[model samples]
Target: MSDKFPDQARVVIIGGGAIGCATAYHLAKHGCKDVIIVERNKLTSGSTWHAAGAYAQFRTDPNAGRMMAYGGELYAQLEAETGQATGWNQTGGMRVACTPERRREYERAITIARSFGVEMALISPQEAGEIVPIMTTD
Candidate 1:
């Protein structure tokens, strides 16, 4: 939103959310000289504000995992590179297997994450309880 309206742009992106901003940055990085992002409000003021900023390393699809990894990388460096805080926190995530079926799903996710060089462990319920004391193993 540098200008209300840019006269010219090699790429015109709608919305100034995280996704749109990231898209604009990459397009410019890859040699798109002029990139313009139009936003109804300030950048990240939309759903980005409400975003939990969760970075899931696991994805059933390898391509999706890569995309998520790239975003995580960007968030990790956004503050350092541009001197602007992206409000990104690297808080860890957990997938609670509340039932046998959910445990199977976690197992699949673990395999997929590991296959793409992402680290994910399939821990026992007891181990999980050790990390989260309030967790109910029943």
Candidate 2:
């Protein structure tokens, strides 16, 4: 076990997931040498490792969509800087609509994503099947 960080450290962060590590890296890059990260498990061993790495910005809230977009960009930059694969996939995803209410929700989400400059398109059942060969149009 490593010694606890000094009492005078500028910042002390808990957890060692992608978010924590990224925060530490940015702080270090900005000349914050007194930053320390404490983790209960190996780095990226928690939620970060289990993340699906999907970059979809579809959400009903505009702010959330924008945040997701920013997160995707940060993840890309992190992978580039560390030369490690973060399993990011840029392939767009589709939310299947099984009912009228679900379709309305998907439409709202699509509009919010578009407001955040996220590229998305609405497709008919046939088009969706074309994109995902395993999916049935029914």
Question: Which candidate has the top score in TM-score?
Answer: 1
Clashing pairs in 1: none
Residue-by-residue lDDT tens digits, candidate 1, 33-132: 7888889989889897786565676677778987877777877898998898767787767787778897888788778777766778888879988999
Q: What is the lDDT of candidate 1?
A: 0.80
- Candidate 1 local lDDT, residue 39: 92
RMSD of each: 2.1, 2.9
Which residue runs does candidate 1 get wrong by more than 4 Å?
A: 1-4
lDDT per model vs. reference: 0.80, 0.80
For residues 56-126, could you state the per-residue lDDT of candidate 2 as single tens digits? 66777878889888877776687788898866667767788899998888888878777777887778999
TM-scores for every candidate against the unseen true structure: 0.84, 0.80
